[model samples]
Target: MHNATSRELNVDVAIIGAGPAGLTAGYLLTKAGKSVAIIEKDETYVGGISRTVEHEGYRFDIGGHRFFSKSAAVVDLWNEILPDDFIQRPRMSRIYYEGKFYSYPLRAFEALSNLGILRSTACMASYLWYKAFPIKTVKSFEDWTTNQFGQKLYSIFFKTYTEKVWGMPCDEMSADWAAQRIKGLSLWSAVTDGLKRSLGLNKKPNDGMETKTLLETFRYPRQGPGMMWEAARDKIVATGKGQVIMGYGLEQLAADGEGGWRMSATNKDGDKVVVKAGHAISSAPMRELGARLHPLPETSWNGSNLKYRDFLTVALMVEGEDLFPDNWIYIHDSKVQVGRVQNFRSWSPEMIPDEKMACVGLEYFCFEGDGLWDMADADLVDLATTEMKTLGLLDPAKVKGGAVVRQEKAYPVYDEDYAANVAAMRGELEHKYQTLHLVGRNGMHRYNNQDHAMMTAMLTVENILAGERVYDIWCVNEDAEYHEAGDEGAEKALPAREQVSEDQAAALNSMRDVPERIVEADADETAADRRVA
Candidate 1:
């Protein structure tokens, strides 16, 4: 970390936000002998959405980060940074609906028994009906899901919990959201996966073969994800290659005439600090960053209009050695506003400071300044207690104490206008600011996982070092192939040698110098390969 007392400073790179993206860039750049400065608004936290919150003696992640990635580079990076601290954890989660807990991945017999013979029959019939008469035009999440899982199962499983998370009717939400999240998942696929998983066929750690939904195990930092970022921060500072300045909120930014950026920030005590850097990588929320620009571009309007979904977690300390066995459970019942519940002990036993007591986080999704967000912490804790008892997950009397954490702009809203707005903003930024690059979820206004965000940062660093846009960060999470592309995709149109066919390899070798990373990482996954394999 850098001393905030410095009134004026300069660096080779100025990064906004100390999240996964910013820290990854900082780590890689600093390791390559570049001077860097990371400016983070929050004085205490470093991982942004991936941070861990310590309340009293109990520690819990804001959003539990399962260190699983198809990208070999991302996986290798994780192993490089926090190898010793990583713990392999079994993945177990369930869906709580109507006072019953159904195993996630939808255990066949459990779901059947819980839904009863008649309702189960109805669900199968509905699935067949949808297969026979699928929706011609699937515009909304409801429509898309109904077509895939049938109306009965969609209503029984997806509808209520999804609505609680997005705070909108399923019909009002975009189908793109569903498509991006559950692209290959269908009723038959889920059933087959569930049965296979039950038989221990997909129990291995993610090795690129298992779909994300079927993964039975994952890695996690022993202390929490923050352990990784905190280590990265210390390593960068120790190497004297970078300085991470905390509590410095960016106030204004302008392009320096000398092919760089001049950034002004306000420190915790209201002191202003100025920095001049040759390049800047921003992971700040697009909306917030747009408001801080000097001589703002035309895309500022679109940036300002970008919407975000906020989240709050109420950590309840209960008097018990055992809670529910699952790492987390989706609260599918519409009766309660709590969207999900997480048992910290299930994530990692070390997460709880006390062996005799269990810590659980009741997660609620809501808009900033809305009823749930504005509710008092005490009331929110009470609500969690009541809901836990109502769901039969815990007893209200056993609740010892609680704490609350509210995260604003936790998720970028994927609405009707988001794509157009983001495109405009991205176009203007790329054209106007040669030295400025946007990376990460809030930075790009894209809903991506931690590894995906890290992949963007890794590519951004490569681009900076190569003195050009050598990689397209946008393609990181587009598909399995992109994730598998790794360093090979940093320079070529095709994947690593063994993953591509001879013709594809020849095509890549013959291609002219492309400005950005290959957009089609999956360009070689031909139908013939699937059939042959």
Candidate 2:
């Protein structure tokens, strides 16, 4: 356990975690000529959630996360790091609704037709009925979605897979989650969109909705989502403004007493070094962060405080043509243990050797010590292939090679108890560490996708550098609500949000004018920020 190093390096800012948030922040800090070092616990990988893995001749991502965000700044930042490698690719998504796949954005015609004429007519009738009455007491995510699209539509398009994603019944999950993710989405908008598309009066591409009704395209890295992070790492390090030290685990955090922070970390090569920094930014999980503080917690958190679930990925290399027209498929059969299947081969043919062969990742939701993660790699691969065949996604007769990788804390579960506890803990951290900022998916323990995670990372770095320390970084989750009895600090936090975006006017307009996005500003903050109230 005695890991030591004579390298003895220190920096002005020590970024903990090399995921999108850490990488982006470190890159920005370095670009600003601030001496920065990115210390990560895993030596083997630089891309955190976005990292790509190669097995034999096949390459796979835990999930094929596409790059598409309303945050153009983040998009430009990504392209700058991986310029020519960025390609505009069409995005195709759907829900495994009612035993049949339906368009994800819910195409008015296709969606109604998919439900079949009878059921579809009934749903439309219900939607009209709901429009008249509306949900007066919408609380949970399910309730909100049902309110917008009606209960029939919610059960078909939202219930099962949504349950699979969160590992919680839709009824139990917070409505804030739905509010944030589908903030501006409305059934009325969908109808308007479909009519416009039919009449060819759809909003022009440059007008801002990138393939609004169509969802025409998304920009993705040539290799995978990891490529963008890797490029950012390279650019930041090459600028001599940042240092990305992989295989370094945070060992200890002690105040330097002179107003900075002293961070001790262990690297993968069995070398340990203590770092000193003027400030610190963390993209690590809040749950582990609590225990990892200088003085350990007096007791492990009882369930009432914090809770999260983990995920597993089985990357299957199949010898076949296109598995499906989609870049991925949702395994909707409740009988299957897997939640989703990502066909990386569909991402790009060159990602694999030949069109004759393919690679896919079957995703399963599980806890850290769960039975799914306990299985051997080969066994897990076999199980994934079997389930894929059951769903007709993969033909077992053509499986070439398979590898499995299990990711712990892939998603932060949002149960009713999570909100209050996360708030209390985040408040304590913010008060205790002026320079410490928590960001990214696990960093704030919110169910944020890659784009949101990267956006969070970008904002965090900017907020600190801009001297906006009191900025609400915890509001990035889907389920954000007002937990305040009074609005003392809410009046004081205007400066931070103003500094976060160049187009503050547009952000405020879109946020304020949209009824669904009523709590949009706060929802984009970290879970810790919202729950602290």
Candidate 3:
């Protein structure tokens, strides 16, 4: 069961998972003249879900990642890692429903015209009825969305795509998610804005007051997002003080008895790797890390209780011109199981090796052992092709080839108990292992973007270097903006827990925004009975 031979390395810090968080920490630690070792489970890629996969000279992103952040430090670090490779690309995304493409912000005339007169009248009537007799208590996504945009519009525009992404019915999802994601916008506002645009009266420059979701352009690496991580990995190795050990996954983490950690990992060949470090930074899923720890903490079960959502991308190579100008389109049609489609050429021309052939990624969200995830690669490709044709976006005859990439734990699940579980686990781990730091999306069980993950790692590195927790890294919000700002590498301390206002403290304690599944009540009762009750 075990290999006799073993390799050992001593480092100031041992990092797990060579994702954005771990790699960022390793790079920063090495740059600070510290010995570091980073271990990644994947043998071929470093960017985790953000990695670009290449097949037959065609490169495609697992899920389209737009490089945009509100944090200056994150943007600076992105530029610092791969300075010359960054390219500015226009951002375009739309929702595809029935047989029409509607602007994401919803242009009034276009949306009305797309829906025939009868359907438009029904939608308006639904909106008026809901407004007149709104649900007294908005508890679930269905309730909140229907209250805002009416039931007809919600079913047409939101239900299918949202359900596909989360793998749950909208009525079973918490309203908090809807409130957070679709904040500052309502049907009335959208109509007003749309009408203004239709009449050429809405000419205003974005002064940072505009909604953050409606981004116009973003920077991306010419090659792919993986290029950024690859560059960081090379730079870390060039430091001569860091080592990135791929194909090795953490098996055990125990105390060294000298106030440090002894991390053991094994590769597919069963070769063991031991890293003795003064500090350990883990970007691994909290559940996996809990299971690997020796003399596990009392609240370790909370970590195990944390859940995750998996994702897979089916990239189809088609023999034709580019399908759409948008980088990606959300498939709101319930007729197909596909959630979204990403166009490689729209992301960057360099991503496609052959200009004549177009590559598009059909993304599906599913559980690890579900039928979709267990589907054969060829079957997945075929399913993608059929769905594309059904959506009128593809021609089956023009399909040349296809490839499928599956990613486990792509999005951390936000269930009813996730917050409490994460809090208990974090409290225990931080108290027991002062030198152990959890960073990144899975590490914290937060659904954060790449920049937010990097910010956590950056703050963790600062804490390690200072030998104390000077920054409350948890204060990094979903917007990738730190609640409190400090100069780069500066040691400005975060305010004490008691010093912040209640609202500020709540913000600090809150996890990044992700939809949570609503727990059902009274399994024995009928739907009508439950509603009446």
Candidate 4:
């Protein structure tokens, strides 16, 4: 059913999106001698949110990606793609609250010193009180965090920043998320480590065994993450068995009535191109995939209900020395709308073309089409400049120029209903379309890091080649644990489909948590209050 105006391609596999997940699949498929056509909507960039944007000789990292993964295969693949570009950089970030900067990972001594003796005493008392009477049935992020680090400390350090990032109250978020994100360290452990460091007794180097949040160093590409994907694209093309088609967006995906997939994509110019493949690997948002399917599956309605959070970055160029040495600073100060600030030079000297000048990116989390997302580029730049001055991190007079970049569907929202919805979609899709494989963050609606995304694609490729579900990709990086030390792909031995018990599979499919909307009653009250005011 191809139109005369449309061009068609035939391949063994078709890959959607050119992100780490999609490109990883395409590269591996082609290397294994399978023909693949990778489609990317963006005309210029390859990496999705991880891309580096360049303007007037300066580069900006969208959200400041760190090249660290617990999976050795992911680490090795990164090295293989961009071998000589990798550089070891010290990890530095801090929490800025009420005009004071505190070390991240909650350094006991520094946090206590910054908080003052009275507040510190209260924090300790609250910690002890919670320790004695911990929440018996922890259900929400607030409950889990309060139990881990006293209510006082949680309010001071965890509440405001987390709310800003997720646009929801901590009480509504799932506790399982906190267990995954802030795992390992606790109030007692932090205090113990702080005292040892202060007394010069903790001289151990970071052997990749430390908590993920406490890692002192990480690797980075000399330019930015985009370099890695671009290289992957080039290698894929060199193979001649693969082609990366840019400026094309998926319009429709349908079964060809012969156990093969026929995908239709359109470019900005409205020109259409089609690819017919035996299998399809998608990294597109689950909601979008559901909508575009022809003869949509039974549970496609569940996919339509999935939600996402969007992000935008405002990069400012300043004429002076770098503002700070840290890679980025978490803005826990509720007064400012900017959530975090990234120092480009700190990421890599090459990211900033000029040594005499500095480029810093201000990150803002917002829903798509919201006020921030709709703001004019010029106004956003001005807003970023003013906020930087207010944070005492920059001087407006020193700013030379600025630019804005918006990324849609930057994060998958994990509301209370998300787990059920994702499960429903997976059940029908896996049963009805065995050749269709979902991978990556938005693909699976999982809030995983780049490594987790890559692992999913890696396992999917294995399943595809074996002509059977040899590995259950959903179980890869199950807890999202960040391990620093391991051989490449050492722990990537994922469970096979037949090997997974029903209970284990259910637990594995449980979606990772993000913020959820408050109850309807609470939402109505808040709206009423706003209207009254």
- The candidate that achieves the highest lDDT relative to the unseen native structure: 3
Model 2 stretches with alpha carbons more than 4 Å out: 1-7, 96-100, 107-156, 174-212, 267-270, 295-304, 459-533
**Model 1 agreement with the true structure over 30-104: per-residue lDDT tens digits:** 999999989999989899999988887788899778776655577778888877998888878888888888866
- TM-score of decoy 2: 0.76
| Model 2 lDDT on a 0 to 1 scale | 0.67
State TM-scores per candidate: 0.82, 0.76, 0.89, 0.86
Candidate 1 Cα misplacement greater than 4 A, ranges? 1-6, 107-109, 121-138, 147-151, 175-213, 299-301, 478-533
Top candidate, metric TM-score: 3
lDDT for position 396 in model 3? 96
Residue-level lDDT tens digits of model 2 in 189-232:
66556667768888531221123444456667777777787788
RMSD of 3: 4.4
RMSD values for the candidates in order, in angstroms, are: 9.0, 8.8, 4.4, 5.4
Candidate 2 least-lDDT 10 residues: 508-517
Which residue window of length 10 is worst by lDDT in model 1?
510-519
TM-score of model number 4:
0.86
> Any residue pairs clashing in model 4, and if so which?
72-488, 72-489, 73-489
Off by over 4 Å in 3: 1-4, 107-109, 188-213, 480-511, 519-533
Whose TM-score is higher: candidate 2's or candidate 3's?
A: 3
Q: Candidates ranked by lDDT, best first?
A: 3, 4, 1, 2
